[model samples]
Target: MENILNYIEINELISTSGQPSVEQFKQIADNDFEVVINLALHNASNAIENEDKIVTDLNMAYFHIPVDFENPKASDVKLFLNTLQALGSNKVWVHCALNYRVSAFMYIYHKYVLKTPFDDIDISLFEQWSPDVTWQEIIKISYDEIKNA
Candidate 1:
């Protein structure tokens, strides 16, 4: 029910809730961007029906990250980052159902891959988006992965 254009920041990357429209897709394609990552598999069935046209019409390379609503995997975060790097996309849109999973992935990407300090991350970013999940566990998981990696 949220607007697709309302994006949240996970460090330098941007994420949104659910699928984008033809106009939103065009905005991404027209921007100085290379790839768009869709992390909305939690709402896959609905997103597919709603945004298939925009996705198919854009004709850009994207990755669908499967996030376990109950228990997400570190490997999923790794895969998401790997996909972004492989695409060489400077501007990427990482999104998920209500932006919860995507936000967690972004936290991992920034904290580990980009070496951004946790203090620099604003908690408001996640709160503003209405992601119906707590990120404490994922944040801890990401920190461990980043520290180890």
Candidate 2:
């Protein structure tokens, strides 16, 4: 509801997205998101040049995961979950270039870490466009690790 690009409210505390413009960052500030997490590659076409600065300038926390689209690892998923958990109850905005990466990671997080009901999640990415093979494997591997652990 904050004018974020590709914004999807995973719940009251977490949201996922594509890259947001400068104006949208202000909207995030106005809407009171306490933290911003970015999973996009730094060289991604729409990647903000100084996104950390922008978010911090708006007085929000920023975390960059920089996932490899070609070779997403289970460890990255672990790190993401850890970061989210460490943030506690703070409202967070998680994002990637086109929401492809964000959506995949969110699927694992919501399903495992948060124990969110499967029926509540809108997984149109997996249902419709679907992640590429690499992401699919990452999601599978991450889910397996969570289930096994």
Candidate 3:
């Protein structure tokens, strides 16, 4: 099976990537990903039509957050975490356009929720492209909000 775009296996249970094609969704299921969390808009470029139905048909839970790329909010981060929490130990695959949104969210999740050290966090996912001012602010604000909460 072809690898999904920008795929990053975070762990045995958690993976991240850019949008997957209809056929790749089947590969995801074949690999035992029990949940698929989509951060891109439904109409995003290359997004599959009826993705929820596609994933559900594969017997995988689907959660779509549809984050606004230019205006990410702390509430989005909170909801992402809550979704993962609700899913418990299930294997999950999270994705967004070019994996940018997912990378930023995963950064906050690792730093704040998982308490991973700044130097220890795998930053390669984001280092490939510099985050603009808006994303930088959201990243800082997101972790700060999570830290203080």
Local distance difference test scores for all models: 0.62, 0.84, 0.85
Our model 3 lands, by Cα RMSD against the true structure, at 2.0
Candidate whose TM-score is highest = 3
Q: Quick one: RMSD of model 1? A: 4.0
Error of 3 at 114 (Å): 1.5
Q: Which parts of model 2 are misplaced by more than 4 Å?
A: 142-149
TM-score of each: 0.72, 0.90, 0.91
TM-score of 2: 0.90
lDDT of 2 by residue, 1-149 (tens): 54566678888788887899888888877888999999999999999899999999999999999998888888888888889889999999999988888888888887787777989877876665567888877776645685444
lDDT of 3 by residue, 50-116 (tens): 9999999999999999898878877888889888778888999999988989988888778767787
Instruction: State candidate 3's TM-score.
Output: 0.91
- In candidate 1, which residue ranges exceed 4 Å CA deviation? 1-5, 9-18, 42-46, 50-53, 128-135, 142-149
Can you give the lDDT of residue 62 in candidate 1?
64
